[model samples]
Target: MIYLDNAATSFPKPPEVLEAVSAALSAPASPGRSGHAASLAAARSIHRARKNLARLFGLPDNSRLVFTANITWGLNTALEGLGLQPGDHVISSAMEHNAVARPLNRLAAERGLVWETAPADGHGFSSPDDFKKLLRPETRLVVLNHASNVSGSLAPAREIKAAVGEIPMLLDAAQTAGALDLSDAGDWLDMLAFTGHKGLLGPTGTGGLWVRPGLALRPLAVGGTGSASESIRSPDFLPDALEPGTANTHGLAGLAAGVEALLKKGVDQIRAQEMKLTGIFLDGLSQIPGLTVWGPRDTNSRVATVSVTLKGYSSSELSAALEREAGVLTRAGLHCAPLAHRHLGSFQGGGSTRFSLGPYNREEDLNSALSALDRLARLKA
Candidate 1:
């Protein structure tokens, strides 16, 4: 099958990633938990992964980074760990995925914290000006998605940072982590949530959160951190402060390999290739009658993900047809960002079809998708 759902989870990870995981699992002991030779080697591997991630993101201290199960867990750690009190205000955009929205909404309901949503432009992008308008003196935290999962609309983090100076910002980088250049996050963003399975091309269950130094977050879990074992209380520090229990060593080993592969290939080169395919697909889809493409038409302002709706066919029907008849696999429906769909005016009807590209996608995949859409349009007609 021609997989076009890389925005959800990348497929066909590099050969090195598979090898690394296998090698790590074959070893005898766990990392950071023992003093044997095998344990030391495993611990070193984990440290190497941390350092690689630090280099990829241009972070100075690799130890500050904490691993989680996925981006959802990272986001939750950032949100729940902040320990916001009642009546405190939190800001987010309408383009946020359920991962960000669900936690914030829960806090608003149970903790009596205030929540406000900023409006996005026509392209489903949240503007800095709109964010500034929503800012109140009581606003304690600002959560923004680096890219919309549905429309692939990117938010201007630099502009938003300039507007809301010193206000702690939590950036969800699930979509943009490995695809976009974000090395300058240390200067502007307070916290970043990232997933290894998506753009990072790692196996599932690998993700992390990076917080600025001196930011204190309450521990979400407390038990067996391999440090301060004599004490019942969790240690108050970065990494061990949030990461409790045994870590996902196998997944992290694969993630380390995946990240190294990305660094070698270069993010700019990957983005350019994906954009080339998106341009071809968008151009062909636009030529088809009764087709409406969503998000910023400019490829520069968006990732390789594109959402579209055919006039007469439901998104599910179009996706199924593409998979069955054309050998193209694309995602359909709300894409877990119903608020984004509402913003794009696709919620009243069925959600739009999503085609997300990865490094493995080729020019032929775009051509095949376009050709299938062309025929599907004629069939509807």
Candidate 2:
């Protein structure tokens, strides 16, 4: 089967990732929970994973990295931890996933925050000026989706950060963490949230958040961090303070291996391959009649995700037909980004069929998908 749903989660995780998870399971050790050798080994594994991810993102201090269940958890932690008072404002892009939107909505309802949306253009592209215009004296923080999961529009992170100076920008790098080169992120981004299951090619239940030094955020939940058992109060530190529970050691082992694979392979190489596949798919899509593509049609301005709508066809119908007729897997509907779909004019039509590529996708896969789409397009004609 041709898997084109990398935007949701990646498939065919690296061999090392599978082996790492298996090894962690075989050992049956809980990190920082015991004093035995196995426990020490588990703790070491977790530390290595944190270090590798910090290096991957070019973060100077590895201790600032905190593990979480996923990007949603990280986003929530960052948003809620801000301690925004009444009349404070938070600005985010219009092309945000439910992760950021829902959390911001909750904060607005509970904390009386004035939530603002920075507008993107018709192509889902937003400039620094868009955010600059929305900046208010009461603005406490700026949250940005580094790239749109629906439209695949890459945000100008550096520019936006510069425009909203010292506003504590929180970057949701869900789509670009492992797919793009972010070695310079430490210099620009104040906080970053990432998921390992997508472009990192890791198992589910593995993700993290990183905060810049001197940025104080309240812990979302206070529980046992396997540290400071003597005191009833939670520890006031980097990771241990934020993390509260038995860690996802199994998934983190796989995540560490996945990041190792990317470090060895280099994200630039993976991005180049995905871009080639995207260009080919876009070229093929243009040849088909009655097809309208969304987002940036070019490869340079977007990730490998491509969204499109066909005349006289619902997105659900097209997705089902693709799977039934050609074994081509694709995701349909709003992709949990109703705000994005609404902004891009795809909400009323039940969203659009999304075709997202990964490093594992081949030229033949794109060819087969294009051929299948051409045939499906002719069905209504």
Per lDDT, the best of the predicted structures is 2
lDDT of 2 by residue, 1-381 (tens): 999999999987999999999999999689999999999998988998998999889999988999999999999999999899999999999899999999899888987999999877887788999999998899999999999999899999899999999899999999998899998788888999999899988899989899999898899899988999999999999899999998999899999999999889999999999998899999999999899898888788999999999987899899999999999999999999999999999999899999999889999999999999999999887
Window of ten residues with lowest summed lDDT in model 2: 118-127
Clashes of each: 0, 0
Candidate 1 residue-wise lDDT, 229-332, digit = tens: 89998888778888898888889999999999999999989999988888888888889988998888788889989999998899999999999998899899
Backbone collision tally, model 1: 0
lDDT of 1 at 303: 92
Error of 1 at 33 (Å): 0.9
lDDT of 2 at 363: 97
C-alpha RMSD for every candidate: 1.1, 0.8
> Residue 154, candidate 2: how far off, in angstroms?
0.4
Query: Which regions of candidate 2 are displaced past 4 Å?
Result: none
Model 2: what TM-score? 0.99
- List TM-scores for all candidates, in order: 0.98, 0.99
What is candidate 2's CA lDDT for residue 344?
93
